[model samples]
Target: MDYPYPKTERQAELIALADALAGPIAARAATVDREGVFPYQNFRELHAAGYLGITIPRTLGGLGADVLEYALAHERIARACGSTALAANMHCSLIGRIDETGMWPAELLERVNRDIVANGALLNSANSEPDLGSPSREGLPSTTAERTPRGWLINGRKRWASLAPALTHMLVLATVVDGDSPPRRGNFLVPASSPGVRVEATWDNLGMRGTASDDVIFTGVEVPRDALVPIDGSATPGDGLGWSAFGGAAVFLGIGQAARDAAVHYALERKPNGMAGPIAELQTIQHRIAAIELDLLQARTLLYTTAEWWVARPAERGANMWRLAAAKYVVTNAVIRATDEALRVAGSAGLALTSPLQRYFRDARTAIGQPPLEDVALTTIGKAALGLSPGGNRDGAANHDAAVPVATVRSV
Candidate 1:
């Protein structure tokens, strides 16, 4: 698929690299999805294409692509395979957020950037805990780290850690020991080969089966003090959530477009006994395809435009996280609708195990459940429209006490 928006010479070149990888990625997607296995080959290809460190600074030997470029990559990769794109999103979003936000030490950031650029190391932030639900919501990770003379010893469990099987580095969110004010929340970056780190394969889902969002167990995992990155507990403060939302929107947009393409292809080839020609020749089929095209156009426009806006104004995003959430909500919802419509147009044949449309439908549904979930997005929009203040940050442990048990929505 051609890129939906205009790009700079560099952006167009980078996007071409991503587009070139789509074939092999799509070829492996079905088997990976069927077996529920991690797409290591896909990651290797992305790494070889220099996508793993695309967001890292050029000074640090990375592509130094902007937010729009990143989103375009996500959208294009996802067009071929949703699972591969989804897993890549976890790695890209985490690193992009760290680079853009600059909360950690310069040396530490440089080390991470060098690792990605030089060695093709993959990283993802593990924050979701089974007990407290979504980290973006009223939950702090129950993972705890103790102060050691060398550094910190981390021992805790993280659920839905995307790209776990392939992670070269993990940013573990944990509660730290404080004198008396309160237990501080810090993110500790631990190497994947650490003696105590374990990846438990627990991701067996109806959609995005190849993402490998399994459980990551940290048992006495040790990291230096420099590994601990400070986190501000406000929703609007960090760039991580915003970037992740954009990535999610891009994934669904691709999935939806794929579904439309599949349906149209099937319609053009399949002929019925009573009909004079293929389904595509029918007026009804033409109208349904037109509707799907309209949805794709609207969703793609919002997805790219918002990303460009963020690239143009990074400072305002910290205060306008709601806009990011809204974009995710709009594009994801549109994709889900497009997939459903495509299924209707394709008839029962689309539900066959051999059909890609069925897989697209399942993948698109998962988009609605990704971070800054639909309910949370709606709440944020409502609060903004009502002129209410976004709430103050609650300490990590304090949040656990008041957090009610809400339905867990996993993002991979």
Candidate 2:
């Protein structure tokens, strides 16, 4: 009920900027999705408006607002454009993770922060491979990062490298192979223009088509020693992924709310012959709309509440992880259900490409399908609630994550 995030002047500026950034994108969301084209103009507006640096702290080039504010900003963008929102969510959130870690070279982090402020440079995980659906934590990667005299030589193909076209850098994750030490997997920060790096541009996606989530091939791509920056070298990996994951739900949930709003607008205006009133007067339509409204309220509150908790106490391991998993699981499904209901309320017209409802429905479906799949979350939660362990009661990683499937590509 009360304000959920910081009310600082910078936060207010970001809120105002986010509204401005969404305006033009809101006007073109449907067409961009239909044509599968990037919203460069919209991105420029956001870039110029400084929403791209919403997560960056003032000490850095960013406004440095709280996490909840970032999530709210994400919601604003997502309601206007799913692709842009998702891309910005990843970029704004990860910069702090790597920045705090003092992992990579200090010079590299400065360059990254500067690029994010000046050019809207984004960072995406080039971790997904053709063989592995979601890169396994414990799984051995086929793409090998071997240490060389010059630097790390990363060779592998990464699928679903979203935001490839607009990104200034790529965070490529590869397993290190060395005869000298025990196996350790490391994440590399490589510039988009490095040698032997190519985007296949095959972004034929079912949803969020404008994202430019193409397959990137890294053939002997060598990132200089400076590029293999690790946040862990500077900071622990604790709570980074969970905070980042739940942080984006507000955006997806807003999209569902947008779809619900659209359905309400149509219901209030459209009238059928002999029906004494607008579609809103009909009992069936009101019933369907009410269901969507409930989902929006429940999901949105959960998103912001959990976001606030993360901001207040990011390292509260048990509480943060459990609550975040619940929020991710709940809001994702809420969007799916809300979108489906919106389609039903809008009727056949909802299926038209010209209509925003159709785009909203499709994109919401894709958004919810993200990893830490709902089914897995339910299992993990159920296990956690009871005294039982997550997966392997013996080890925490096993309980939370399944054994990483070793991925090796065999020629088809």
Candidate 3:
């Protein structure tokens, strides 16, 4: 598919690269989903192609792609395999957050960036807990980080840790326990190979099964004091919702696009015994396809336009969080409907295990419950329109309690 939007030459090249990998990745997607296996080979190919460092700084040997570029590439990847794109989005969003926020110490940021550029290391935030649910809510993490003479000892279990099978580092959100002081939440950079860190194979899910989003148990895990990412109280805050919201919307949008294409192809070739021509001749099928195309176009337009607005007007992002939330909500729900329509178009054949439409259906539905969830997004938008305080830091207040992780919504 030709890129319809205007872009720089570098951006076009990067998008083309992503498109080139889509075919090979799609070839393995069915097998990966059928086996419920992590797409390690996909990540290897992505790393080799330097996509792992697409959002990192050029000074750090990365492609230094912006948010729009990231969205386009991610959408292309997701068009082939939702699982690979979703899991990889976690890593990319984390790195992009670090670059945008300067939330970590300079040394720590440099080290992590170098590792990603040189070794193809992957990182993801382990913020969701079984008990706490999503960290975006009011409660603090039950995961505790105790200060020790040597370093910090972490003890907690993180649920829905995407890319757990191959993570190089897990940025764990833990409540810091200090002597006689108020407990505070902090992010701990724990190496995947840490002595006490273990991955529990509990990621049996209905969709995006190749993500390996298992439970990561940190039992007496120890890391150096420097592992604690230094949160600067004075630095200008970056929009936590930008990359994840836009990138996630793109992923689901791609799934919808794939579903639409599959449906069109099926309609063109599926000829009934009594029919004069293919199902494509049916007005009902044509209507459904038209609806799918319309939804996809609207969703894509909103998503990309919001991303461009975000980059072009960084100063207004915090005040316009509702726009971001609306984009995500629209794209996610649009894809779900598109996939359903596509499945209807394919009839029983689409339900067969061999049909990719079923996978697309499942994957698209999975996005419904993701962060910036329907209720949350609607409430935020409603509040904003009412001239009320869009709570949860929608107005850009420094409320760490409502600080959402870069990868708040697990794709699985």
Candidate 4:
């Protein structure tokens, strides 16, 4: 695929930035994967190019690009390096969601914007827990926030917190403790350097090694009371959820595309000694390539189209969450299948640890376990079809769009 990018100047600029960064990011991908370390240099380059704040509105010291543009950028970067793109996705997703959410204090939000604009401070949500598993399926957080005269004292361990090694701020989900009423769930904005904030080196995995998604342990971490921001009405619900599901789909799709390209390139160059020349002359190889193309085309179309829809119809976001979740499942499942076919086409050559195809295969597998899981997505769609409405009033209210523009640095 070739996508006819939008006519907007902002989209063009973002595409250009992605094109420029692809080469260096691609060059370092293998090294980053092998070392299982954070892509510090890749991020430094992104900061220099002003992409760290790509989703922040221009008035708030960011480019003011929409969610569609953000998805486009992720697809481009992912084509080059899935690991780096995944890390950037976490940061970009957090920034975009936080900026949209009007819950944060004006002064604190402005401070965050300044850091991202000037120093490229990164952020990501630490929601997953070891015992409770994914928090998406209605589980109480192991993390606890206790009231203190100074502020709130937070304690807990968050597993698989992407970008943990470099995140400047962590949106920590915790059960608020205040004595009487049942503990309420809320998110606390904890600065990464706060005392007792420790990063455990536990990210060694099958793929996406560069994300450094280690376990982040918060012990007696304190933050101002003002930092507890409610997630509803503040964050753009559909867009925020879409960023994770849709953005993830883009990354895996890119990895699948890369795998297809590599397999095709290799098939054209390597010839067997049977009778003909390269395997490209064979019908079997041709059919496999065609299959990969078809899967990718379908996946990309759904991913981008839904992204555009999310931006254009903000009011119906609540209604469309089901479709978006389904889109993620459809696209990611296609990616896994496409990558497997590519590996089959390339045969032994694709299996080498040094081969990019191997990396794509492993990385593509990572998408299967992400939030809004396949079973849940299918269930949601099924429920919708049965006329049983899906749960979630997060985006149903009229006040969702009532947030003041962050460009003006409006206080809550």
Candidate 5:
């Protein structure tokens, strides 16, 4: 069967749902950002609206929306509150991947989803390490999963773990010691209450403060065999991050549109001492606004087109590793420019803390440095398009340390 990324009907329904869920809480969620706190209640509301596990299986009491529809929903969420949207986006992607595994730890999955739906249980992935950056590549994990008679003993430090404060369960990716082939890398579901796992709750970032991204420490935390969500043999479309790529692009699209909306609104309202009327009516403002529209259109097209590609040939959708990066790069850069232009048009008042534009400017800047950092992304993308091998990113040396065997570690 052909994969429909975003059937029209699904889009319409998602848009309506997002409007209702995010509209009223937009202001409140932004306030949470200002207060440097988590948007707990806002996410609870979103969960109640079925946004928590919207991409999960229908048998699991979820919406089970398609990939494109999922992205559309994320965009709407982002437009309202960047932090809330980003936090929820992480969980949605994680759950979607877990659902693909189909080895849902019956009681664990239900409890986790229940917390997300009713108790605002946010789930996140602990992939980035303080010593070795992001570990999605072939990097050796410094975080070891030592084999013990009592399941697996994990001990590692994860940095820049977004949404940790609100997260009840986290999938920690680590390397396992074995007597056979090579040390196997896998992910395990760790509950917050699990012994030896604690959150630092000390993220004081410049943007997206409401994300509550903090350092998570694991000290001899033990997970039973059942807690491990093995990805070794998983070969489904969902297993390959099909929905996550599209979802990230969609959220960024929302952020870009939010800036666009602000600019438009400010144009009509702010009346400069121009030749005839309001600043929006001025030729200069009109021209810049038109450029913004072009940026938005182009970026949106890139995202939607990428989604379409994924749906058509899900297996050949590897381009997303870089394309999604580009989409995020373009959208954030576009929105940042749009926000700056809007501020310039608004003059002094736009820089004030009381103004939403100022907040957006700060928030948008944060996205640039996040996971798909523009610099690394473009480099990796260039290598891929040119048929060159991108063994690893800037963190190659660090990844080497994580994946390679140290001299001190003798063969067991």
Candidate 6:
């Protein structure tokens, strides 16, 4: 599991650490998936290994790694367990965004960094609602935060709350209501132990069951006025969605690589009843393996290249979002194709409960609906290629009213 690209000493070190933890994590993946339980033990290891604060700045007692390192480490972890990697991605992406964009207030940022560094506190954004769906779409949150005499009171039900089983804090998006003023969206930092915060067990799904991405109900959850982190509508120096897009791509690519490895191993060992040698000698098997490798090559190249470009060219990222979207689109679909081909290579054994390939297949399918889904990615790329703005109008005249802002929106 050598990294395919050049890396600094620090990046190599982090990747190696992730690889080291992957083996033990992979061993427990089967039971975690079977029982649909959260990988609490896996998180303990990750936290103890200092991966929980990998993205926070060094001054804040963290590794201060960038997006490339984050992507690389996540890929290694995902190669062992998609659920662990995906759930961790939620926490890492939030910290990554806060680090990349100096958007949060100094006190709030310091508090979050301290929690992660000192206590390995895990956090995630609660954005998607049952009715509003993904926040990436053009709709305001139905969740409301009213200004109270003492503080802000929040009330809403958020679905797909990943890491709900052990969240220390949740960045909740809610529409703010003030006296005689129009409603505005705000990102409120709500502690998990709030008086009215409750997690409902409703996350049984097709795959990634270990994520514990259940529903969280916030009823009259109160937070201080300082808890409200204002949303800046204007574009910033860093791309807010970079971590989500690249980190997610790496996870799926890792899953694809695992499938490819499984197929190769099985092919080299399985000898048919009448064959001269193992299935590795078969032309059809070789062709499928070739296809899997080709997909991996394409996906890795695009995903890593885009991530490097993002790190190298920060000032130009706002204009180059389509490239990030394209990487995600390509990696997810390539991984899915690779897994399907791997299953074909393994034949009946791939479908057995004892085989990890079936689990890989199910987990890979979950990547399709993550943020910047297929349709959304295609729409962004299509618009960019057609010389139109995000609003779908020509000549770069974007209709701000209709455009969806690129914020931190997570999926199950």
* Alpha-carbon lDDT, every model: 0.78, 0.71, 0.83, 0.79, 0.69, 0.85
The better candidate by TM-score, 4 or 5, is 4
The TM-score of candidate 3 is 0.93
- Model 4, range 1-412, lDDT digits (tens) per residue? 7566655887888888888988899999888888898999999999999888887879888877787888787778998999999888877766777677656678888899889999999888788788966576656888999998988999999888888888888888888997686897778888999999999989988989889888989988989988897654544445355556666677887888888899899889988889579998889999999999999998888888888888888877765467677777888889898899999888998898788888999999998777667787787766555545552334342232222211110000
Which candidate comes out best when scored by TM-score?
Answer: 6
User: Each model's TM-score, in the order given?
Assistant: 0.90, 0.89, 0.93, 0.92, 0.84, 0.94
RMSD of each: 5.6, 4.7, 3.4, 5.1, 7.0, 2.8
Which lDDT tens digits does candidate 3 get at residues 286-402?
999999998898898888888888888876655566777889889988899999999999999999999999999999988976787788788777776654644244454423333
Winner on lDDT (4 vs 5): 4
Which tens-of-lDDT digit does each residue in 1-412 have in candidate 6? 3446547888889888998999999999989888999999999999999889988889888888888888988898998998999999989887877766777878878888988988989989888899987787757899999999888999999999999969999999899997888997888999999999999999998889899999999999989998888545545633456877788888899899989999999999999899889999999999999999999998898899889988887766666567777898899999999999999999999999899999899999999779787898898878865656443345654333334337456757
Q: Please give the range of 10 consecutive residues that has the lowest summed lDDT in model 2.
A: 403-412
Which regions of candidate 3 deviate over 4 angstroms? 1-3, 231-234, 391-412
Q: lDDT of candidate 3 vs native?
A: 0.83
**Clash pairs, model 6 backbone:** none
Give per-residue CA lDDT, model 2, range 1-412, as digits (tens): 1244435665566666777778888888877787887678877777787777776667777877667777776777887888777766667667755554446566766778888888778776777777765554346666888888888898998877777777778888787865587767777888898889988878877788788778888899887666655644323324345336654676688689789888999899888898888989889999999899888788878878777666676445443255556787888888899999999998998888777888888888886456556665676566655526432343334234422112211100
Evaluate model 5: give its lDDT. 0.69
Ranking by TM-score: 6, 3, 4, 1, 2, 5
Best by lDDT: 6
Model 2 regions more than 4 Å off: 1-12, 100-102, 180-183, 231-237, 389-412
Off by over 4 Å in 6: 1-3, 231-238, 390-405
The lowest-lDDT stretch of 10 consecutive residues in candidate 4 is 403-412
RMSD of 2: 4.7
Would you list the clashing residue pairs of candidate 2? 57-64, 101-234, 101-235, 391-399
Candidate 4 residues lying further than 4 Å off, grouped into runs, are: 234-239, 391-412
